[model samples]
Target: MKFNFLAKEKNTVVNYENAVAFPLTPDYELYAAVVTTSLNASFYEKDTTRLERIKDLIQKSNPVFVAKLAVYARNEMHMRSVPLVLIVELAKIYSGDSLISKMITQVIQRADEITELLAYYQMANERNGVKKLNRLSKQIQKGLANSFNKFDEYQFAKYNRDGAVKLKDALFLVHLKAKDEAQQVLFNKIVNDALQTPYTWETELSKVGQLKYYNEAEKQKAFTQKWEELIDSNKIGYMALLRNLRNIVEANVSRYHISKVCDYLSNEKAVANSKQLPFRFLAAYRELKELNSKYVPMILDALEEAVMASAQNIKGFDVSTSVVIACDVSGSMQKNISPKSKIMLYDIGLMLGMLLQSRCKDVVSGMFGDRWKIINMPKRAILSNVNEYYKREGEVGYSTNGYLVLEDLIKRNEIVDKVMLFTDVQMWNSNMTKDSFAYSWNRYKAIAPNAKLYLFDLAGYGQTPINVEKNDVYLIAGWSDKVFDVLNALDDKNSALNYINRIEL
Candidate 1:
């Protein structure tokens, strides 16, 4: 939908001519749009104008979202180079927000370049109005100790000795000496230990055997014994298990070993302790399904239990409003949002649609592209329903005809309290009709006068098919499930604006 008040004004009168120009996007929407669109050049490289507009928006948007965008880029997208630009821009707008310090630590932990880490530390020091010697030393030590790359370890140590010392006061050297001594000891141990290689679930299990000296045959026996002890001991955390599922399968351990690991990882106690999201469990299920290993069934069953257990933490909407979730499964959605990431826009749309459906008692879920049809989702687990929906409808069409969703619902005389369309907002009427989305929306409005349409934009196309001001339509964009958290505030008449203003700086 067009936001007319955001246009650059030539006079006091509203600039209707520049209505299609860049509008004042809400902080959440801007953050979501930029973070998702910035993942790859495929989205922005083709449309330089949209890219420039987003960049301009970032320069003027709130710094809180800027920090959030940077964290999302690093943690969620696994990005290295792209987030640096945002981090640099964020440093320019820094105003002593503690969030910036957290972002700095994340960057230091994940960044490959020592120079980038140093730059972030300098910014942190400036914001805190003091050289944070202890904090910086701890962050550096943590990064070095956790690093799997030899080069990164060396670089972090080198920076700690040469670069960090120069930036700090002479009094800081006392603490630095202690940190240095600890680092040297840790580094020597890491280098001398053969089992201190990349720490994975399997590797951690192997470490148990390395705890004591033993012959080859004796070590094998000890490993088996220790593996069972560790499994039964409940020492392995859920994140360790979730991230290293492949390692566990490829270890070729006995079925009993695998079953025990799965049982502990997916148990209610572990799920509650780990605080893993339902979508993360769903993602794990998808990965295991693709592997098609012998343990797939067992792992899926365990993960299903974990997902159900974790669902209690997700606060579903308490409103008694009928809802319909229309997901876009068009060709554009197949494009990867991030480089080397298997998660595409289509996968995210489906997952979010199913997530919303799972939260609602009366919700109609459907997929749309060139055509539209109601999906018959069974009352089962969330991931099961998603898999079943995909199996029933192999693939939706290519073109993004979002209008067809409203049209089909209107034709069937199915008036819902709300229609949530998860799409890129690049809707076209394949029927060669004018204003098809608007036409169908108006017709639906005739029947359901109070019904609202929420267009969840996965891609930042900067355009919409319907006029939001004239119709009860709202736009929310982002890649994370946090985007859904704004729905409660959206129930107000002001929509996202109210939520944006209420966001803590």
Candidate 2:
């Protein structure tokens, strides 16, 4: 199943032809790659062709891709780069239709960063011709009325004075440092209102009280008092509880509070209701455990339970096909997937392999680097299995021997319906030949002519091991579960290109 919209070229170069090969690349990976490259601009700043290729891909992407890109940029990449390039590319593709409007609305509703929200609004108002400034102002005003915070106040005043709007009622609820008489009046009113509000552990309102007092000693006293109250309450929101535990030392909270937080963090009902991805919980647990080994004893059981529950929620595919999941654990994969992330590409590959394994009934798993070996994946929690596989890093070696896996499978004469490789797609033979993957894949095709190769590119290096234009080969990039959506799209005769071309207005 070949997607008609993909590039027809057989080259490995990063050009416009190769750029559009995977338009459905996960939104998170696409933005992460672009932002990562942009931050390290010194390397690709002079490489206009590569940059333009990425921009071209963004411009030609479908609404679903564009919408997800907008959300990712505003949320995940908010504090990274300006996203001006992406915004420009989005303007070229988005026409402020109902779909794009809904996308913008979703972004605005979830965006918390002032700078990113402003940028989003500017894009909607200037490029897409959507009159959103007034709507956003009203939303901000209502938010301030319901739950006022220092951050919201700061943004409100900043944007208000910048001519975004000056809601007289909400403006008076915050304090501004501006010299304008009107601004001063609003700021003073906000300070007075904040001081009047009762300080408690109800929400973040106590933090607002501390901010309103504007005295270091008074703020510290209030914060400590609030922490004391919270400890006695013995109840905390799931996310806030995790955050508090993460910053236990700085929080200066009690061990009793820490214990209670851990209890909630591991609570089976809460964990099940959290709906967080198992991989994410595992990653957070690993970081927290490393930060303070003491946390391990308290939270490890809950983390494992959460992981198992999350695994139960995963819906496996009903495809009756034999599958091979090959993961790349080479030295190159040790580097973080993005500069802002601590997660390495190897972690992503492992997680993705586990996810695919969960969805497939007849699947064989293998890990390859300098050599290839068939892995007997244990039936256990996904995180535990991934950790066990990770512990064998030394045995797999550091070189990328991707072809060996296919070659070994061919030798075994295994009848495979599909072969999926989770990698950066930068495959090179031990002998330094570029055609190792291609050569081995060709040989496998001769034996299993109906088999298809799905390259799950974890890193968007913009190079593929095989010519993606080939009917038997497919390329998908990203670290999102939605990558599985490609499977449904593939079942159709037109592949993912049909959905991409649906032209939803």
Candidate 3:
């Protein structure tokens, strides 16, 4: 069967060691097993062989059997497994390892209210990182606090998993740049320690994981003492909060979960006495509507901005740049170095697609590997949280004939002036595209010889060099500040127009 990331939606849920949702007397052993298995990178990267060897030893009834499969696939990509990422994300969601997952809970709670809230949180957080605004906006971010991480007592704190952070608390702290692979590894260790130290799912985290850790349970508990604080702050649902947070970061967040949002709101209303005004009536009612209204449009804006920003030096182009975004939909594109990295890229695709459409309808968005078609309308809308605008879609393809897709688009008459291909740049020729470079560009030359190519290096999987100055192929690094600056700076029309008015129009 063709791998479709969107197809996994049917199985997603919360509060589980497995597929079960929030078991009241939850199986701690199951939770323990799932947690231990996910944290061990060696278990994920090189454990497939070990798992296969122990399959007979670790029966289906054995906790380790599932562990064997999940770990081997997760780190090693032994199974070339797409499901492993899902499992890890679920583990993080239910157990609460990362703050992003926690912040995203808002959207999960109310799919509709996600847009502006997420935008505000993200903007505030980003601004928090730099000395920009004279005053920081106080948008409460317990939004992610519902899926609170549980820290072990201080004696074992360094070896514990710290609880998740609030959206504002986690702001730009999510990323850390390093001078080299060693520093990167060091950074990862410190950051990981902070995330997992006080609450080790099953084991102690490395030194690098300590960079972002703090023991402030007193403050958090004191702050979230009442449920009213959670609701008023918009931290009502785990997924809803996380979705909003992700949207802010321009990370691919899940839909608002309209059905889930309504479900929660309905249940909350059910629990209240509404003879006059229901106790939680206003909160529940408003959250549902907000989830529905804000989600899609916010997503559209975030995606559009992200895609535009992910590209380099486009803000001031005197001419409108036409973009044909050709991406890889192969099963492997779902593969990620880490959960954050993968989510960020997926978010990047949507954000950019939306941005291109608004910035210029002249832009077209599509995915290809073995073949090509635009995600064009998500192909079909799947609303969640009464407010969701779109949902992730499942599609099919498995080869990188990006060269051909590009060539075909160029061969058409009313040509685009520029083509921005957001892909990993791993195009190997088959029986057809043996001379992809010549055939593709030659055809492009026939149509719009002046056209330029801007290669968006999503995740840096591309090994081929495209000299920006020489070939007009400007490349932007994924998950870097350059991604943001280039897109924002592309064209600042305000001051530019002010300069052109020799006499006012």
Find the candidate with the highest lDDT and give its number.
1
Tell me the spans in candidate 2 whose CA falls farther than 4 Å from its real position: 1-53, 60-88, 92-100, 111-115, 120-244, 248-279, 291-295, 318-321, 338-340, 358-361, 432-435, 492-505
Regarding lDDT, does 1 or 3 come out ahead? 1
Task: Give candidate 1's error at residue 237 in angstroms.
Answer: 4.1
| Top-down TM-score ranking | 1, 2, 3
All candidates: CA RMSD in angstroms? 8.1, 8.6, 22.0
lDDT (10s digit) by residue, model 2, range 1-505? 3664343443234422222122233333344355334333222223454456566667555546665555554443332332434543564455534444343343442213333444444554563443334344343333333323233444443333323423443334222244567546545654454322322344453454646775777766666667757766655555555545454534555666666666676677887665443346657666666664454566656665655554454453556778899999988777664456566778878877886786677888989888888897854556666787788986878777788888888889987888889876667676565447777889999998988888876656555666663758877655655455554466425443443334332
What digit string (tens of lDDT, one per residue) describes model 1 on residues 45-87?
Answer: 4545544555566677777767666665555444465455565
TM-score of each: 0.69, 0.65, 0.38
**Residue 175 in candidate 1 has what lDDT?**
34
Off by over 4 Å in 3: 1-225, 230-319, 337-347, 378-396, 465-468, 480-484, 487-505
Which run of 10 residues does model 1 get worst, by summed lDDT?
10-19
Q: Which stretches of candidate 1 lie over 4 Å from their true place?
A: 1-29, 35-38, 42-54, 64-85, 93-237, 254-256, 264-280, 290-294, 314-319, 392-395, 467-470, 494-505
lDDT of 3: 0.36
